[model samples]
Target: MTDLIPALRHLLTLAWQCDPRRLLRAAAMVAAGCLATPLIALCLKGLTTETLAGRGGSAVLLGLAAAALLVLELMMGHFAHLAYFELGDLGEVELQNRLVALAHGRPGLEDLDTPRFADTLALVRDDLPRTRASLEAALQLGGLAIQLGLTAVLLGLLDPWLLLLPLLGAVPVLAGNRAQRLLDTAKESAAPHQRLGRHLLDVATGHATAKEARLAGAAPFLLARHHREWQAGTRLLGRAHTRAAALRAGGQLCFALGYAAAIWLVVRQAQHGVSPLGDVILVITLAAQLSLQVGTAIQLLTVLQDAGRTAHRLDALKPLTPFHANKSDATSAPLVLTRGIRLEHVSFQYPGSTRRVLDDVTLDIPAGTALAVVGENGAGKSTLVKLLCGLYRPTGGRILVDGVDLAAADPADWQHRIATLFQDFARLELRLRDNTGIGDLDRIDDDAALSAALDAAEAAPVAAAVPGGLDGLIGRSYGDGVDLSGGQWQKLGLARALLRRDPLLLVLDEPASALDAAAEQTLFERFARLVADSRARTGAVSVLVSHRFSTVRMADLILVLEHGRLVQAGGHRELLDAGGLYAELYRLQARVYA
Candidate 1:
């Protein structure tokens, strides 16, 4: 109930902000509808009394009033529904916008990967589509409360003892709250399993995985796994719902007993000439309305409780503030790096893990140089690249760009001056132009810029051959779109990375994993030349991570990593002369080519 009031207020404020006139109209109609119910019952009682006294004119007038009240009760709700339905939709859009802003406004990537934050975000997303229904339920619940109170008052005026019926209805409201809590707990417990089930289903049916699934003949296995997860989630929820239904049923049964006792008391009073037929009629009508109102209120309260939980989840996520929130230094990133990037005893490990991915290591790269990082799988090459890109802060020590602490600089400003192309790059299902232009949104429509970037990535011919050239859609998901091979898509990703103008730091991690050996060699040669040119112009430092020794040799300097430590560092010829991890790995790869 404490959470309920705040949640209701939050939703009402959103609704009013969305459309104030509609909100006012809806409220007026709801109030009128609530008042009409008790008035209809009063009119019914008056009509019955007048007819019994043989007052024909007064009875006719009372009958007409009862008819009008009945119409008002029925039609006012419809009018309110009409007024608020669009308001509810607008409220939904407003809520979604807020959630999106919250998810994106944070400057650091920590909150995105944190497990508790992820779970809370998922819950909010799941509840987002229910915003409209929740608003309507809240409004309906208010109207029901008003109607229930008025019915109780009318009964009290007739006989004070009948007021106990409304008090009895409170039992169901309390039961409903308990039932909702149980259901909420069960739903939360089931969410992970449900998500897993959906993921398995997507893998089995997705376009990307279809060929693999067919060759492996794993359809039956995937289907069985999905079924297991689905059933596990449903079973937990089913038990909770059954228990909740029983609890609610017991409360309603108690109400039914009270209702029967109240009817008997009224009948006994009339039999002893202590009550009139008109009063008995009024009591029965109000009691029936009270029963319906209680049940509706219980149902509406359940919806409101679910929405309350969503609101609370959002509040819980408030502390996952932006990483640089309270930092005194809000320095802008350097326009040019004269001293290049320097890592001083930098170290890092993922959240909730004790095993360091990168140990205490130090290195320096001069400006206008191409530096290559080579290592075996799990050697922390990618983790090092992430640190250099300012995606993750070093756990120990610090990184400096142009002698200024990278940690103190604004993340957005740093990111704006850097560009990266990772192996698992995003395949945006958009046009060829958008695919490349997304790298520099400010110049997305600049034809000369797009053409130059495509040429730099050796993708110009591929784009020109397509039906619509730069405007051609790239994914089969769109009708009439052209589907590219794996290598072609990688070229587009490379083009996108090149589209970012004059970046001070350019990091490429296995950028040509999908291309052939000849194509890979050609791509690296072009990148080496581009890095040299970009460095001379903007003093950019380019970092390369590749398994191909042939490509690694193109860098001005190479750093060899073994188990997260820089075991060897020197030029290609220098490394071969100094026999170590790098020398041994180079020979093994040379044998494969030989």
Candidate 2:
């Protein structure tokens, strides 16, 4: 009930922003149409009275008036639709844009990984289609309120007891609201299971997993798991819906009693000649219209409430976004890393978890230097990279880039000066050009830049092999699209990363993991040269993460992490000479290849 008014206001605001003229016209039409219902009933009563008195002229005039009111009701509603339809469409687009901004507009990426945020996002996405109807619902609810008022006044004129019908209508409205709340709770509870069910369905049906599922003979297992999740969610929602229906039925039953009593009272008055037959007709007509208005109001309330929840969910996400980390008067990042990056006792843990992913660790990375990080999986390598990229803030301590606090620097400015390639890079189903060009949106269409990036990543051959070269589509989801192999995709991702020219900090986190050993070595050599070129131009800093010792030894400094701790840090030869974790792991890998 509290959310209802705000929801209507939001719809009106959206409508006004889209087309104020249309909104005003729609409201006028809806009001006129709603008034016609009670007016038509009034004419029906007048026509009955004149017919009873055998006044042919007056009866015919009243009959024509009733017909005109009926036409007004139908025509006004139709005209309202004509005006509101475009407003609804435009409002839906505006809502979707707002949702998109809520999801990705923040500087930090914390909310993207949160389950609650994901649930809200899913719910809002499902609500998007109903945005069009929500506008109409808001208008209809206002018109219904007016219609109910007029009906109540007419009933009061008939008899004081008859006025109770409108009050009785409240029973169903309250019940409907309760039912909506119950269903809302059920839907929120079922979201996780529904999401899991959909994931399994995608896994079972997706082209990427089809071959593996066939070889593993896991189709039946996946189907059974999907069915379990789907059934779990379905059962919860089904029970809520059943209970809601029963509550509605009970309320309507209570209203039905009042409706019967009012009609009986009016009929009795006419039977005893205490009131005219025309008054009985009027009472019956108005009472039936009151019943219809109540039901329509319930349906409209349900639509409005659902949209209200979506708006509330969107509002809830605003605080979760990390905009507070950004300063209104932010300082610009350094154009070059003269003093390099320094991490002082930096530590991090995810939002709700206590277990630290990156424990208190201090390190310095000099400008124009190549630094390598090596560790087994789950050693906080990626978390460290994320912090460096300003995608996250440290739980303890701060990072300084060339003596400027990274946290205080403008996130957009810092991001613009850095480039990265992570292991699980995006496989965008776009044209080959866009797949690579998206790395630098400003230079997406720069052919010279594209060619250079392709050459640096050794992806020129891959692009040439495609039907339309860089313009060729990259996924089978679209028509006549070309699909690349795993290694080919990695090369394209590397090309995308390399497309960003003159980055102040270059990060390649296992960027060539999918390629063969020889290919990986070749790619690393090309990357080393690119790093050297950036360093020469702007004293850049580069961080490389890889398991291959052959690749790790190329770095000017190497840091070994174990269980979120910096266990060893030195040059390749110095670390080997120190004869600790680095030496042991290097020897073991050396033996495997020997």
TM-score per model over all chains = 0.93, 0.94
List model 2 lDDT by residue over 344-368, tens digit each. Answer: 9999988778999999889999999
lDDT of 1 by residue, 93-158 (tens): 888888877776556565666776777778899898888888888788888878887888888887
Stretches of candidate 1 exceeding 4 Å from the true structure: 319-321, 326-328, 465-472, 478-480
Clashing pairs in 1: none
Error of 2 at 552 (Å): 1.6
- Per-residue lDDT for 224 in model 2? 99
- How far residue 154's Cα lies from its native spot in candidate 1, in Å, is 1.2
The prediction achieving the highest lDDT against the true structure is 2
lDDT (C-alpha, whole model) for all candidates? 0.87, 0.89
Instruction: Report the C-alpha displacement of residue 42, candidate 1, in angstroms.
Output: 2.3
